[model samples]
Target: MPLSSEPKLISGNANRPLASAIARRMSMHRALNVELVDARVERFNDGEIFVEMFENVRGQDMFIIQPTSNPANDNLMELLIMTDALRRSSAQRITAVIPYFGYARQDRRAKARTPISAKLVANMLTEAGVERVLTMDLHAAQIQGFFDIPVDNLYASPVFALDIKHHFRGNIDDVMVVSPDVGGVARARELAKRINAPLAIVDKRREKAGEVAEMTVIGDVSGKSCIIVDDICDTAGTLCKAAETLINAGAAEVHAYITHGVLSGPAVERIENSVMKSLVITDSIEAPEPVANARNIRIVPTAPLFAQAIMSIWQGNSVSSLFDHETLSTIYDGFYSAS
Candidate 1:
C-alpha cells in the first residue's frame, strides 16, 4: 500500500508499546517529529486536574494513539489536552485512534436521571477538535452515531477469528462460541458462524458493577469446548462466572476471547480461580503487571490489523474486505491451530 505523505502518528504515555508495535507494522519510526508534553497533573489545595501539551503539530495530519484504559480519567485528559494542543498548533487534521474507548458502556441513559456519558465523551472529543475517530470493538455499536465526525469502528473478531482458526485447526465442530451476556450475543454469533461452531449465551444478571450472577446457559454447551467472547473484560466477573456455568454445563473446557483486557481490581485473581482454561485478549489496552504475569492470560497483538486499516484508509481503499466472514474464518482456523 502506498503511504500517505502527510500521515503522522503520535502516541501518549498510555500503551506506548502498542503504538510502537503499530508504527513497526506501518513501517515507520516512532513519530519523533511531535512531542507530548507531560501535563504534570497535580492536586492544588482542593482536587482537580491541570493539563498542558509541550509540542507543536501545525499543518500535520496527526493521529493520537491512546487507549482510554486504566487511569481512564488521566488518559482521557491527556488525549483532550493533546487534541487541544494539536488544534492550536494549526494541524491539518486530528484523528483519535483509541484502541479501547473507556466509559463506552454508558452510551445511553439507563435510568430516568442518568447521563449518557459516552455521548458526553464524544462531545468532548469534538470540542477538543478531533476531526475523526478510529476505535475498535465499542461497548455499544450505536455509540458511533454520537460522533458527527467520521468514525471507523474496527472489529477484533477478525483478528481473534484468525487466532482461533490457527489454534483449533479445522475441527470447529467441537468448539462452541459463547456470549457472556445477552448484549454480546451478536458478537458471539458472528464469531460462531465464522468458525462454523454452534453459539451459546450465558444468561447473566449484574447485581451491581463488578458483580455478576450467572443464571443459566441459553444454548447447549455440553461436551463442547467453549469460547466466551466479549468486547471488554474489566473485573472478569462476567467472564469468570460464565466460564463456571459453561463448565458446569458439561463443557469439555472453557476459554475466553475478549477484545480489550481491562484486568482491573481482582480480575487477575478471579480469572486464575475460575474454570477458564485460557483467556485470550488483544493488545488494545495495556495489560497490567498482574495480568501479564498470570498463567491463563494470553495476549494477541492487534498492531498488524490496525496498521493495515490505517494503510487502507490512507490509500483510500475499501476496508470492508477486512471484515469478510469467509476470509476471517480461514484466518481464525489457521491461528487457532498454530497457537
Candidate 2:
C-alpha cells in the first residue's frame, strides 16, 4: 500500500469517535492503506469555524465523516467549510460521509411557504464542492433525488437484523416487526422480511410536529414480541405511545430499532418511563450523555459498515454486496460482542 494511493479520512467535531472507528477498521485489513487525515477544525471566539489540514492532500481522495445531529447548524457548517478547504487544497475527490443527515425530516414543503431544507442542504454540499455523498437511512429515501451527485443511502436493517438474531437466539416464532406509522411500513417490512417475522403497523395521526395522537394497533400483537422499526427517533413521543398501545393490545414485549437516535427534548426521560423493553439504535448520530446512560437503550457501531462501503466505493466494487449476509456476515457477526 503506497502513501499516494491511501484515501484521506477526515472528521468534523460532529462524531469524532465514529470517524476514528472507521479509520481503525479501514486500517485493520492492512492491505488497505486508508488513514485519517491529520486536521484541526476549530471555532473562533465569534463562533466562526476554521479548518486546517496539517498534511498535504493534493490529488488524494478525501472522505469527510460528519453527522449533522445536535447543533445541526454548527456541524453542517463545519462540514461545508471542511469540504471547501479540501477542495481548495486540490483533493482529487471529496465525499461527504454524513451518517445522520439533520433537517432530513424537513425534506418536503409541508406548508405553503416552507422551504425544503434537505434540498437546500444538497445544494450547499454541492456548492461546497463535494463530489459524492454517503449517508445512511435518510428520513425520506426520496431525498436522494435532492442531490445532483451520486448518493449512497445505506440501510441499518442488516445491522439491526444481526443484533435482533443474537438477542432472540434465532427464535423468531413469536417475533413481529412493527412500523410506528404508515410512512415507515417499507422500512419495517424490510426488517420483517430479513428476520422472517410478521409485520404490524401502528395507526396514528399527528396534529403537529413532535406530537402524536392516540395510536391504535392495526395487527395482532397479542402474545407476540414486537420490534418497532423507523429511520429516526427524535422526541420518542410516537415510539413511547406506540409501545403503550402495543402493550395494551396484549403484546408480550415491545422494543424499538431506530436508525438515528436524535433523542432530543425529553426523549431519554420519555423512554425511561415508557413500556418499551429495549431501544436499539445505530451510531449514526453521536448520542448525548443521557442517551448513552439510558438503561434500556443500546448503541451499535456502524463504522464497519460505512468503512466497507467506502472501501468498495474507492475500489470501484459493488457496495451493495456489503449488505448481503452471505458475503459479509463474518464481517458484521461479532460487531456487537459487547452487547
Candidate 3:
C-alpha cells in the first residue's frame, strides 16, 4: 500500500520488543516505514519519572506503542507526559497504541463507594491530548464507552483461533471452549464458533477479590479437552481453581487462551502446580522470566495485528476487516504459528 505520509512510532519502557516488532512489520509491508522516535525515559534519584522526545513530530501522525502493564502507574504516567509533550510540539494527530490497557478491571464500582479508575484513565488520556486509542481485549467491553475519543478495541480471538486450529490439526470437535466465569461467555462463545466446538461455562462465584468462593462446570466436559478463555489472568487463583474443577469433572485435559497474561503474585507457581495442560497468552504485556520459561505457558506475538491496525488507521481504511477469517489466515500465515 502506498502511504500519503509516514507516521512516527514511539515506545515506552513497558514493552520495547513489541514496538520494535511493529516497526519491522511496517517495513516488511512497505506501508509506512518510519523509525522509532528517539526518546529517553529516565528516573530521578527519588524515583520520579521523566520523558523527553528528541525527534520533531510537528504536523506529523504519531503513534505511541505503550502497554500500561507492570509498574502500571509509572508507565501510564510516561504515556501521559509523552502525549502532553507531543501536543505541545504540534503533532497533527496522536494515537495512543496501548496493547494492554491497565486499570481496565476497575471499570465499575462494585462496592458502596469506589472510584471508576478506567474512566479516570480515559479522561486523563483525553485531557493529555490523545486523539485516538488503540487497545486490545479490555476486561470489560463497556470500558470502551468510557473513552470519548475513537477507541479501537481489538480481539485476540483470531490469533487464538489460529493457534487452536493448528494445535488440534483442524479436529476441534473433541475440544470444548470454556468460560471461566459468566462475564467471559461472550469471548469464549466466539472462539467456540470459530473452531466449531462445544461451549462450556464455569459457574464461579467470587465472594471477594482474589478469592473464588465456588466453581462448578456447567457443561459436559467429560472426556473432552477444555480450553478456558478469559481476558486477564492475574494471580491465577481463579484460573488454577477453574482448571482443577474442570479436571475433577472428568475433563481429559485443561488449557487456557487468555489475552493478557498479567500473571502477578503466585501465578507462575500456581500454574506450574495446577492440572492445566497449557496456558497460552499474547505478547500484549511482557511476560516475566518465570512465565516465559514455564513449561505449561506459551506466548504468541501480537505485533502483526497491531501493525496492520495502525497501518489501516493511517490509510483511512477499515481495521475491523482484519478480523475476517480469510484475512486473518493470510496475516497469520505470514507471522503466527503453532510455535
**Model 1 C-alpha lDDT per residue in residues 1-339, reported as the tens digit of each score:** 433354667777678898877777566432333233333434446545444545545666778888888799888987888788778878788889999999999998877999999999999999999988989999999999999998988888877777787777756679999888888889999888776788888887767765664468988888998999998887887778778888888999999999999888889999999889999999999877888889999999877667766656666677666686454443334334432
Q: Which residue pairs of candidate 3 clash? A: none
List TM-score per model, in order.
0.87, 0.96, 0.96
2 or 3: which has the higher lDDT?
A: 3
lDDT of 3 by residue, 1-339 (tens): 423368789998899999999999888876455678999988899988888889888988899999999899999998999898899999989999999999998989998889999999999999999999999998898998998889999999988888888887745778999999888899999989988899999998878876788999999999999999999999998899999999999999999999999999999999999999999999999877999999999999898889889988988889998676557777767554533
Which tens-of-lDDT digit does each residue in 48-140 have in candidate 2? Answer: 999999999998888999999989999999999999999999998999999999999898888899999999999999999999999999889
Candidate 1, position 138, lDDT: 93
Candidate 1 residue 313 Cα shift, in angstroms, is: 2.5
**Candidate 1 wrongly placed segments (more than 4 Å):** 1-4, 28-56, 205-214, 325-339
TM-score preference between candidates 1 and 3, better one: 3
lDDT of 3 at 233: 93
Instruction: List the candidate numbers ranked by lDDT, top first.
Output: 3, 2, 1
Q: What shift in Å separates residue 301 of candidate 1 from its native position after superposition?
A: 0.7
Query: On a 0 to 100 scale, what is the lDDT of residue 246 in model 2?
Result: 95
